[model samples]
Target: MTGRPTTASAVLPAALRAWLGLIAVLAALTAVVIGIQYAGHSEAGRADRWFIDPTADSVRGTWRNVALATDFWGEPAGAALLVVAAVAGCLLLRHRRGAVLVVVGAALAVVATTLVKSVVGRTIHGADNLSYPSGHTAFATALAVAVALIATGRLGLGRAAGLSLVLGAALVAGAVMGWAQVALSAHYPTDVLGGWCTALTVVPLTAWAVDRAADSRRSDRS
Candidate 1:
């Protein structure tokens, strides 16, 4: 072996190390978002009030309808459908690893979002319970990322434009859902941001872990 790392370990470590940096950044952002909520910062309060008050009322016509329609993308049923579609697409393309990664990453994201929301204990005016991190936004963001990953893998090299378009559309759709949450007074701005940070943190780390586990399994077989 010439003192070199094995192929599985070498391949996994570089990607995992890069993801660690991203995960740390996202974790810090999530913390800051939640901290602002918990500290009762004026900025957070003002933003929430501004969005939920007159702004919500001002948009109560056609714009509100559009936002309401867009918000469906983040609903539990919609998110589940998106996840299933992404995983099924991967499987149809014979990207079994991608399918597994998407499923694991999305599931972890949901669990993490729920736990964070419980721990943060932030609430919206019309909501029944805590709402620090919006579960709908988290699910939508995770679904978007999962679909982007699968699309990028399928597109491969020499298709940068195609990959970019696919990912951009997915992200834009997720952003629309987040905006809709604010417009509907379902969550604060910080809540949406916190959900996105949690999704970004959870998905990549979950994918890295899944990749490492797959690589280890292959190495064992070899």
Candidate 2:
């Protein structure tokens, strides 16, 4: 006998749920490990030294300019502009839920990083600076994850395609912003890694929560 048909009220597909669980576990675990290793520290650790060049700046000239351009999008004014544009794009695509996700996800990622930084007590440049996780990197990654999730739903993609899109977007955005932070000496390489993981951990969970809440409201009305 065949199984019952899927309905609008059905929970997330098993493949998608498993994918989310994997992403969340790995991301959160990585962030925690890095934070523990660097807690209450100001200088780059052994792992960080491998990535940082002692004698020369790795990013320079044209590449430095590119990095700066990418970095700008993570700044306060730039991030605000990005949010406005993203929200407009979501509306144009007729995805109000996606628009809300973009706004809320980005804010939560940044806030989460800030709190983690405080607890991690990691610093760079000086004692006053607390930079375990790069907030800029977190913001960029969060935006990308939101967009990817929106695309997945809008296109009605399957498990593999949706997971691929989300992971790819998150990786690209995280790398771009993380590189910028390291090149500018704004944060340690490990800090960037922490930031990337923070978004990876937060965005998917937030999206799931949003879906549940929306579905609950719809069910109530029905």
Candidate 3:
């Protein structure tokens, strides 16, 4: 009996299996964004008021301080610090691919959010600002997604374990930053949701692209 030779696609077939669910996730994100755009458009609508009425501009004391601190992580200086630390960790682990994924994923997520904001024309504080898909939330969530992906690869986690880690990290990061944005009255609740979904949509795709590129290079060398 003769056996077929394995090709690069066969070897890396599972590379994208981990993110199959993203198809559904991407659809859901799209639907939600469209709904928000139709109803909320350039300003907060009933749904935004429903979520923001109780939480927005109500934080105080220790909570306010915490929110401010969390908000800083999404800022340029704090984000740069985090990126440096993450890159350092990846290098220590000798996971050069992971380091690239972190940097590229974060950059892409932030850029995507900015571009969406301009097109969506959503604003919270004033007309001068664009707030749909809160950049801070997207940045924080992107970092979490990057860390989760790197950990998944380094630890050789199974699909279930990796998925759980990614989702959990994304949720925690998104919630923390989303809460901060709302508390600061910097964005509507829907904007935060958009940001979280944007990270989710961007990071995994980035990871898959990175994997494909690496695998292609390996095949070429072989």
lDDT of 1 by residue, 1-93 (tens): 233333222212342345445554766576566655564322246655654563444358888998887777667776677778887877787
Cα TM-score of candidate 1 = 0.76
Ranking by lDDT: 2, 3, 1
Model 3's alpha-carbon lDDT is 0.76
Cα shift from native, residue 81, model 2 (Å): 1.1
Instruction: State the lDDT of candidate 3 residue by residue for 65-167, as single tens digits.
Output: 9989999999999999999999999888777777888899999999988887777777666677788878999899889988877776666677677678878
Best by lDDT: 2
Residue-level lDDT for 41 in candidate 2: 94
Q: How many Å off is the CA of 214 in candidate 2?
A: 0.8
How far off is residue 12 in model 1, in Å?
A: 9.2
Q: Mind giving the per-residue lDDT tens digits that candidate 2 earns over 90-137?
A: 888666678888998999999999999999999877888999898999
**Candidate 3 local lDDT, residue 16:** 37
Better of 1 and 3 by TM-score: 3
Error of 3 at 61 (Å): 2.1
Local distance difference test scores for all models: 0.64, 0.84, 0.76
Clashing pairs in 2: none
RMSD, every candidate, angstroms:
4.8, 3.6, 4.4
lDDT of 1: 0.64
Model 3 residue 34 lDDT? 57
